[model samples]
Target: MKQQNNTKTALIYAVDLLAIRPYSTQQLITKLKRKEYAPEEIQEAINRLTARHYLDDTDLCQRQYQAYINEKHRSIKAIKYKLMEKGFSQSDIQNAQEETDIDEIDYEYTVCLRLLNSRYIPSKSDKLKCQGYLYRKGFNYSAIRLAIEDFFYNP
Candidate 1:
């Protein structure tokens, strides 16, 4: 049947996509939909993949969070926003954060200080520019203020 063929094709396409990199279930669904696959076919494909344990938002979210923190040194806000943009549910992102057991503010403060030390020059004129740069990098006002103080006074 044509429907059966389409379902098989959808599953094949989904598998090929997964072979390249991990995708959230929603992301995979969107891709299939974009390809003009029927909604039923896409859902069937998604269900099959999930049953195979090939699509797990929780696992992906945790790994992504770890990479953002340990490898990219992304701020907590940036990590959450990035993961959300990648189609992870908010609860999954929160669970990943909790499992990581890192104090968000303190970790961000340390990263902020490190960035400032590496890239910023301490001068009255440059201070404002530096603050703006850190803010743009997803550091909150509290972390930015504290890091700037520590960078200037304690250093």
Candidate 2:
């Protein structure tokens, strides 16, 4: 009966995820485990979902990347981090990110302006803080430098 219950639970979980939106195999497994599913059950459910076309990693990657692009405030590095956090593999991140064709801008400058406009005038200490924040937000060194330049351009 325990096995049966697990199966039913997995099915319910799958249905819930599908009803909300599509997901990737790894993403679904991670979510199911979060909800206390057994590994075997989660794997079975993931396989079922994949067979039913409710979970396709490629499609999910494209959709997610496109959504971020449409939102327009994200840099590629940040998008890659988001995908990684969502349990995407390196290959998946590379593939999905490549599909994104946004013009690369100075991420630092862009984010710095956002920070400054929000009234975050940076002193030396604040500069360090902002740098850390951008790093955590997944901006590359180049982008972060551009923002710092803007912040320090107070002549």
Top candidate on TM-score is 1
- Residue lDDT tens for model 1, 8-58: 588999999999999999899888887888788888889999999999999
lDDT of 2 at 123: 59
TM-score on alpha carbons, each prediction: 0.87, 0.70
* Model 1, position 101: C-alpha lDDT score: 76
Q: lDDT: which candidate is best?
A: 1
TM-score of predicted structure 1: 0.87
Give the CA lDDT, 0 to 100, for residue 63 in model 2. Answer: 82
How does candidate 2 score on lDDT?
Answer: 0.70
Candidate 1's error at 103, in angstroms?
1.8
Candidate 2 on 30-146: residue-level lDDT in tens? Answer: 677777777787777777777888777877887887787666566667777787788777887778767867555643356545654464655534777767876766666787777
Candidate 1 lDDT (Cα, 0 to 1):
0.86
